[model samples]
Target: MAAGQPVVVLPENVKRYMGRDAQRMNILAGRIIAETVRSTLGPKGMDKMLVDDLGDIVVTNDGVTILKEMSVEHPAAKMLIEVAKTQEKEVGDGTTTAVVIAGELLRKAEELLDQNVHPTIVIKGYQLALEKVQEILKEIAVDVKADDKEMLKKIAMTSITGKGAEKAKEKLGDIIVEAVTAVVDENGKIDKDLIKVEKKEGTSVDETELIRGVVIDKERVNPQMPKKVENAKIALLNCPIEVKETETDAKISITDPSKMMEFIEQEEKMLKDMVDEIKASGANVVFCQKGIDDLAQHYLAKAGILAVRRVKKSDIEKLSKATGANIITNIKDLTAEDLGEAGLVSEEKVAGDAMIFVKECKHPKAVTILARGTTEHVVDEVARAIDDAIGVVACTIEDGKIVAGGGAAEIELAMRLRDYADTVSGREQLAVRGFADALEVIPRTLAENAGLDAIEMLVNLRAKHATEGNARYGLNVFSGEVEDMSENGVVEPLRVKTQAIQSATESSEMLLRIDDVIAAEKLSGKEAGGDMGGMGGMGGMGGMM
Candidate 1:
């Protein structure tokens, strides 16, 4: 070693990008991901058809769904995906807006960095701007009520407007609102799981219907059992009605044939006794979580009971919520008090498959939406759209607040953020203004997707927001002009907008702060096969982003 020479400590197999190189790569990765999904924005947005290695196809315009389906490896790109996931988890809508804003924030920050502004100042500016943005959103949001069915329907329609289900937005909107409102508990808390969506192809989207109770994709266990029951008394059983077998294998030594006959009779009698218990409880409808043996089915049929076997555990829980029934673990414990009442329980063949529908409950906390379509892909996409609609409506019901859609919230927020940015001093002011500019991506992308002049629409929107009581004005893609979104019945849950902005800002700030990246290299095939020592697991992540 030469004097005054620094010695290399890092492994020769390691690859590192420092300072400008790391930031540039990270920002470019984010922009690429953002650009990939930017076209799928607004009502006129296009859909993405993703096919995996297994040849399974997914057609969607939902931002989170698209991101989840992609094989993303870049660290920064994955963070943007997380932003979309968080937005979807929190509000169920506005995922695209969140991701687009994050990408634009990074793009704007890149320019500021090129101008020699420090990253810490940029992050601080974004933080301050985030706080102010939240305030502006709250001030502009309109109050909503749980009982306002019309407004709630509008929110649902707004969420479903841009997806594959837009053609049936009116009907789906009503179904979404009804389903969500049906599951709201007395405490005004909504468990989104309580709303179940079942997709069946070979029917038009207009044929979709909402059921006041749960729908299990199972049929009667026996052909002799009743196909339909009126004024149904349901018995939800977790235990099997069949005779219990010994856990350990044992040889059965029969001395005579008559002994075997007696043994068979005894087993039959045990199953009969179990069926008698169910019949005695006045349960005409039975949903079993376990199997029902042939003998047990005969006994149940003889008692004029409708029985379904091998029902899923989750379905059993949903049945309990919908029918107000307590699941009985043992048949011997079942009684009239343990049974649940539904006006009707019937098995119907839908889309050439058997499914049991329990409907007309007094006030079910769980309900099902049967989504129908003409094709498999159409049905899948429609189901996803309904899922998003359900999520947003539930959010509105819980938050009791909404804001005008059609990019109105973003435009108003940008206007307000710019005004606030002028009050700040130093280099942070530029970052605050950058945030304001980044928000315009929503309106601009909306116009671009609609094939309208983005500049003209933005100019009109800004002019509109410049006037009093015009804060709710936004671009109407169909007319190619700015109009009040509220008057056009375009509105969404406040959570969607706020969540998108917050997640976007946070993710962008995190990406902007990254100034270095070190990736470990993988060993060659022969060397890797020799031994595992000195080989780090991070070798698989080499060249990421």
Candidate 2:
């Protein structure tokens, strides 16, 4: 088995071993894990309130988040979680579906095994069933020919649902598609930082688009700062201020007019020295983190320098990348190329503050993927979904799109697998048939995780697809039978169609035929769940195969 060839499970012995309680524990553990995430599946799915030992609480309907947050003890449950993690990592969209389908598939196989069916026969039957289900899925899938505006919106909506931002979901989709579309290079791939969404303290629908770059809330302190600078060039510095101090311990006490005059003269001399040093450095655009005194600012201004005073410590860093200016804030002198160009000028009043967008820096971390909403919190959630969308989109763009995050489509594939499993012929046929039959439960498991009654939701999907061409009109499978996805859409992301099919096909074949769970290891005593006597707490291990 360790030689790396395909593993196979014979129908008779497979059943005999898994049918025993000890061996069955493996199956039991896997199924239980799958069921745990069943109720948190879709847009309509209810949320899970997970509380950790530290008493931290997370209320989320996101399947992956919930799974990662909760604690599961059973080793089999851990295996199921691993499967979900694989699915999620491979395809950002399908964690819930994988988990849910896996649970029910195990459940059905267990029942069939109890009814005297062998494991190998079920595995064979499921293999046969897989082709049919794939055929059905292909037939059912609506091919979106090219990226049209409407089609692009549909793509965004697919990621927006169950995200709790119903009103802004559709609108945000348009923004994503439109923003990304404009930035697509001649080579056809979107640039990484072209479309960005940042979190801000602003009301909803305050969206603005800029042909040139726009800064979110760039600021500078001091009235002596330049009102405007033409043809501004800037430098970005990563180093800290290394200015030579005039004195290590200098204190001023204004006890007399003579002392006051002396203090003023000393301060003026210090300021003059700082300004003269900066001017000598050759920067017309000076961005400073350390203090810029009034006398220094006046001197720099007189020297024809466009000095930006009191730049925030963080903005100094970010703007540095944009401006191409290296800082010697505390250092005596600087250079021209170090002061990057301050390209554009734009100002805004909203979210209760006057904000300026300074631009044309050499490099910016993220670009704004502007979206409009009606309120503050609404826009906040919209921003969150946008972040998730970015993660999903970026991941898909990187890896080949694997599968839907939710399990609806994959569960259907599993059902097809079970049907295929049923067609096998064997002396140990019954046990194998059990496995094949169990595959049918994948959809129900998905629905259960998403918080819907699996049976009822599947029926609705059938009814809708039969009558209408789309599943959007159908209820969400995870929650109780409910109305459509509302703002949700059923289309897949750009590259996942092939991947989803491939995963379904491969997992079905591997899972059904496997007779035993063997790990080549020195630690053998931890095998607590799988004994030949019977299954663990939940049910028989037949479905687990």
Candidate 3:
């Protein structure tokens, strides 16, 4: 009976590809994404100028930024982008390495697939190799403490050396170290968020400086307010200094001119009372997160208290941390204990704009880095570079471990993994060896980008790693010779390497497991109209019946 029955068919608009075809498509997508960012790696790498649909331009070599700016439509390729983002979020640097490694892993897996190795077997080998690499990384990593200023500077400099900030890496590195060090609490907890970066487009990148306290890109609300307040007792207020309207709608109607005058006087008295309360609390400066009425500003100036209105909530929180002050919401609740003391609270002109600087804070737990560059693009890139530096430094402080960079660590791990693969006794061993070869891609890319012979560099690096006490030797891009990366001050946080490997392996495995791809057709206006017409036809047919 079933032989004579009709078979159901999928709609023409729905497309599905399975098995080899699907895997090939996904692998191709992954490879293409990797190739897109491959050229922008290491110090010798070139930058990518990405222009969006609206013609806005972004010139950057940062991996995450480049990937994010690209309008990738493939689902599989997007997964690779996530790998870069995760690496960037976790380690701040090494995003390019992570994406490139993931791509290489997939390329190697494709080779294994061609040789009749099962995807499961290849993935198992990758997992094993990843675990082994982490162990190797830990073995080679050096311990760093909170007070190790020299080592911290090296870590920061290493993170900044390859990017646009390289021209002033040393100076920027010092500022980064000082900013992070100043914000580290006594308990050794380093919060990268406590360090603020402000960028202004007017000077060279080297003009960037670190400030010991918070810097607000705002000025005194009233011109008559003191530009500089010495022995500042800052009051951080969240509530509005303006008289709030009633929560429920109401109206006041005055039948006489005298009544209207009394109403205006009452409002002024309320504003004056708010300012009086702030003065009585012993606060000479006010940072208001909400709006301050004009009357309140007048009274505050008359009282000789400097005030800034509508400050960002984040800035208010930072001011509290930096000044050791409490944020008060209600004027009635304001007290002397809520006031934060600063040696000087001043409004100064920066790049033709007035900026408030709260300086000389006692033992500030938060600080700022004012980054200056000659153009908007330069300043933006410098900010990105500084952010990476801060992130790596914070990660190192938290993890208390560092690794040699410039592909040195990758070479060591690849060698160690190859040796470990020999201990295995199955076809999976080939996959493990494939994983080892994938690790070599990092150094190879570095060599290629630096215009050196990739093959020669790899051979020399392998030979050097085989020798005793030469495990940390890496290709120094400038010298084009293998050198000890650690001694050369090319160091990075251990988390960068570990996270890159972990994310790349996970992304590759996820991609390798995709054997089917089904895409739903996107509806256009014509299709939507046809569907609507079909519905109308059905309605007409019912009416005729």
Candidate 4:
């Protein structure tokens, strides 16, 4: 480790074209990522067949998945990848939104910088505008009544279908509504958070069940342990129920008979005492935090108690509840108790589709997202979309409704944004107008993908926009409110509406203020010029892009 001078690896020059600072580089990189994948969100959105520098092809429309595949080396290009990841993590379905919004936002910010707007000023205005968007969200949120089951269906179906799931969209949407309605208390408010969403493949929606009590396939050391427990008094333990002691310190000693005898007596007594304590705690079924001990097991089973051993870490998390004998880890550290339910993982098969459904969980943490399609992969992709929709629903259920699957609502929103641009202030209104324009891509992409003529699709969408009269546009994930869509078959990425707003608002605020391109990348004859080095995760992300 000799250090005369610090290692000064130079940045690739591409960033210089954008700007020298960290912010400028981020803008450049973000633009690359967003523009690269912007057209991959809707049905009409272009599908990218990203082939890596090494000849591997990725084929899909999932933004995170695609970005995961794409290889990017330029520092500027990597910024967009971060934005895409941010979108996925935040909304579960807004990768394209981040790209489109970030791309355009960068372009706008670059212009502002050209016009002598300080990066600081652009950031300030964006912060203010962000608050305004919250107001927009509050106002845009729709209210439904007791008779709004159909309305809910409209939202669900639109969300499912928009993501291109066909076979199970309408059915699952209705099923979701039924599942949600099953647990709604007498109170007028429907806590969407209470319903859990688990994703599975192979089994059709028909074979799903909702259980009153939690059931698991548990086993003890001996096969003779009970397979079933009735009226089970369950104690959810967050520690190992097994009797085996884990390694704590490295040691070797066994010279004296007295020492050996003393150790044996202590361990036996401790095991017996632990078992007695567990049984006396009124727990017939002990869910361990870690593995269980053997002697502790013998006493519990002899006492007619059910002792489970070796639960996977994930299973432990799903079942643990705080503030109960629900044995949480003694250590202060623990996973968040989203609910006392696990996701649906099935090995059953029914026809072509694998059996899939959200299992027994009333907590908002437990949700079964049902998406559909003809093929397994297609269904898988749609299922992924449904999962993203779950998050979007989480964020918006309090104040939003679903639109149609074909980007109909997005187009409407875009139009409105343009119309209202004049009413907004300064360059910010122009940014909002741009947001409206960007939204139209959803429906337009859907129409294009469905094989409709571009101009004709636009006309039809415009006509529908006028007729629908500016109602909220989204999928009815819980109800069967979609029609003509399956036949026409338009799809969007998961959670298009809210995600778009979030990605756009964020990117605009972040990007529009960039002052200059201090550095930039220049691709040259096979190798990208400038020393941006290899982007860690962006390789082969072309499929979704």
lDDT of every model, 2 decimals: 0.89, 0.52, 0.88, 0.51
**Residues forming the 10-long window of minimal summed lDDT in candidate 4:** 338-347
Query: Distance (Å) between predicted and true CA of 460, model 2?
Result: 5.8
Off by over 4 Å in 2: 1-23, 86-88, 112-147, 182-187, 190-196, 201-234, 241-366, 369-384, 391-489, 494-545
RMSD in order of candidates: 3.3, 10.3, 6.3, 8.4
How would you encode candidate 1's per-residue C-alpha lDDT over 1-545 as one tens digit per residue? 78999888877666677898778878887887798889999999999999888999999999999999987777778889999999888888889999999999999999999999999999999999999998988898889999999999999998899898899999999999999998899999899899989999998999999999999998899989988999999999999989999899988899999999999999999999999999999999999999999999998998999999999998899899999889999899998998888999999999999999999999898999999999999999999899889889999999998988888888888998898998999999999999999999999999999999999889889888987556789888999888889999999888998899899999988988888878665577655332211222222423332
Residues 1-545, model 2: lDDT tens digits: 56879666643222233334533555566555666666655565566677788987766655567777766544455556666566555655556655655565566556665766665655555445545655655654544433456755665666667665545666666666555554454555554455545444444543534223335454433345565555665533333223335457876457899888887787678677766766676655566555555666677668766554455666665454444456553444455545556665334454665455655543443245544455544455566566545544544434323233334444444444445545655633353344334543544544654655667766765555446544334444434553444334455553343333344334533454555543322223565344331222223433222
- lDDT, candidate 3, 349-413, per-residue tens: 98999999999999888899999889888888899899999989998998899988889999999
For candidate 2, which ten residues in a row score worst on lDDT? 531-540
Error of 3 at 28 (Å): 1.2
136 Cα displacement, candidate 4 (Å): 6.6
What is the clash count for each candidate, in the order shown? 0, 79, 0, 88
TM-score of 1: 0.95
How far residue 236's Cα lies from its native spot in candidate 1, in Å, is: 0.3
> Local error of candidate 2 at 78, Å?
3.5
